[model samples]
Target: MYGIVLSRRDFREADQVITILTAEEGKREYIARGVKKIVSKNTSHLEPATLISFGIAEGKKEFSYLTNVQPVESFFHLRQSLPTLHIIGYSLDALFTMLKEGEADSDIYQLYISYLRFLNTQEQVRLLLLDAFLIKLFSHLGYHPSLDACVVCEKTYKEIGLEFLSATEQKPGFYFAGGGIICASCKAEKQRIGEVAYPCGIKEINTLRFLLASSWQDVVSFPLDEEEYRLVHKLIYEFMLYHSERKWDDWGKISLIMT
Candidate 1:
């Protein structure tokens, strides 16, 4: 079967255990003996962010082991940029964090493959790609943050009449804990319960709507101002972490307020 390497770590002497994500098997772990040796044939194919075709030996022992592996797409271009590497770091973190082992999710697997290909070829490694993937994945998992209406009052975004760059604390904000956008009126009640809502305005809200509604192809062309993109990106990461029950506990620093 073919899969993308998710992560790996040293096992006993000269051996390592690897985790991979596959469409059929979802996420899995396998032992690759002697993988740390200088003559290891599969060493190069084992790197994280690499796609490889491999055979697994269902050993009599408790763990399945990799029998053979051949390189598929190395995504070599990402190696050239530090920022892109960081982006991939956060992306992979989210993917593995949200995915349950031994569970098949073909849609998310496809999105993962397509996203890597897009990142590999595209020079602009914007957070927009990560944003789109997270939103798309959430939709696949059936957990979109209530983007269209206030989670409290049920007012549509249009009815809220959100304004861009409106700096008043009275403005409606994205309460990650609350699962979506909330109007100013509702924000108070949430604050009374101590849920912090990161302030977001029209552009952030609309951009998120467009992302959640569109395909990856369409999201690539969707125009966004720098600040607007950052705000939405922040919201996506925070929403995922919060709703995923802090599965991505390390995915901290999503702003408490959109600056």
Candidate 2:
């Protein structure tokens, strides 16, 4: 089946344990023997984000053994920039963390392939693409945040007059525990009950909504300034962390890219 290599680790001698995400099988671990050797032709096909078609031999153990590997696409351009490479690495790490073994989701597989394709071609908005990818990934995993209205009271932003706020005073008025933006009425209730609410600014909120709702091609042309970029990044990252119940060690380093 065709799949993208997600991660790999050296095993005994020249063998390696490779983790791959496939369109049919989801995330899988395979034993690739002797691929680490210099003479091995499959070495390049096993790198992270390398798209390939391969067959596996079912084994008695949980992990299967790889048989034939034919390369399909390699994102060679990603190797040009350190920052871009790091973002791709983190994206793989996040995908690895969220996906469970043997869980196949074809949508996720397609999304991953699309992400790699975007990184390979687009040099300008890698970070924006990263943010959109995370949002879209979580959405496919059933953690899509409520963007149309308040998650708590179900009031639309227009109903609450959020659009009337000046640029300098726009606040996301988001409550994480509530799962999205908390309307003014719900915000007061949160305060009355002593719950902490974070502000995500109207511009940032609209930008996020746009990202989640827009197509990949549309997102490529979406306008974003430095501040909006940082805001959306922080919001999506935190939202993922809260929903996934996972922490990324390199988040600080990733955040530095936004600055």
Q: Which candidate is the best by TM-score?
A: 2
Best by lDDT: 2
Off by over 4 Å in 1: 162-170, 215-221, 244-259
**Cα lDDT, model 1, residue 38:** 96
CA RMSD of all predictions: 4.2, 2.5
What lDDT tens digits, residue by residue, belong to model 2 across residues 1-259? 8999999999988899999999788998899988978999999889998999999898786768898999999889876767678778878998898998888899999888888887788565446767788888888888877777888877787754444364434344678787678765577678788986666667777887898888777887888887677777787777877777666563534654543
Error of 2 at 18 (Å): 0.6
TM-score of each: 0.83, 0.89
**What would the per-residue lDDT of candidate 1 be over residues 1-259, giving only the tens digit for each residue?**
9999988999999989898999999998899999999998889999988999999889887899998799999999986776567767777877777788899888888888888887787665555766777787887776867877888778887767643235455577887765788887787787787778777777777788888777666777788776677677777777776667665533224332112
